[model samples]
Target: MSGDRKEVVKLLAEFSTIGMSVAFSIFIGVGIGYFLDHKVFAGRTSPWLTLIFLGFGVAAAFKNLYLMSRRKDL
Candidate 1:
């Protein structure tokens, strides 16, 4: 019963962190993209880099989730 309870707690922690991980990943990607667009690209293109990197961030988040769920030691 103690083991089961530990597992439940672990699962709760994991599930709670999933949302935050995804959000932070996307935010970081967007931040980088925004920097690149304004500071690096400089009016050559606006919003395109941000959009592209945001998509990449979303993909990376899902990939993290996929790998996490696949891990047996989780």
Candidate 2:
């Protein structure tokens, strides 16, 4: 295979790994937050917990997009 093609493949693999790690971390964080909200909140306001998850989710998405944008040449 050509050198450029090899580099592209390598970049893609790295990007996918990073993206998947972020996604998984987000999933785990949200899951734990939900459980805590359910178990600890009981009757109290939950907007803070919701907002926390929202912020993390958005941050994860933006990070993934940023990483993807960095490899435009690939």
Candidate 3:
């Protein structure tokens, strides 16, 4: 029914919003951490490495979410 289709669309929109927010939060957190690490700890041990890893992790999460969104079954 049209109503069911509308509902599905609405749910998917909400899900996508949540997924994007999570991805953006991770990206921003990693970026800020990396900036501070290299800025403040340039002469000492670098925590930027961890930020790099976290950035990749966030990117991977976004990729997976994108793939899932493409699936017909959701």
Which candidate ranks first by lDDT, i.e. highest?
1
| lDDT-based ranking | 1, 2, 3
| lDDT (0 to 1) per candidate | 0.88, 0.72, 0.70
For 1-74, candidate 1 gives per-residue lDDT tens digits of 69989999988987898889999989988988888889999957789998998988888899889988898876
Runs in model 3 with CA error above 4 Å? 1-3, 41-45, 48-74
Residue-level lDDT tens digits of model 2 in 1-74? 99989988888787777767777767866765676577788626465675687568668767777877786575
Between the candidate structures 1 and 3, which one is better when assessed by TM-score? 1
Clashing pairs in model 2, backbone N/Cα/C closer than 3 A? none
Residue 54 shift from truth in candidate 2, angstroms = 2.6
Cα misplacement distance, residue 47 of candidate 1 (Å): 2.7
The Cα error of candidate 3 at residue 62, in Å, is 12
- Residues 8-31 of candidate 3: C-alpha lDDT, one tens digit per residue: 988878677766776776777676
Q: Residue 8: error of model 2 in Å?
A: 2.0
Candidate 1 Cα RMSD (Å): 2.2
At residue 5, what lDDT does model 2 achieve?
Answer: 93
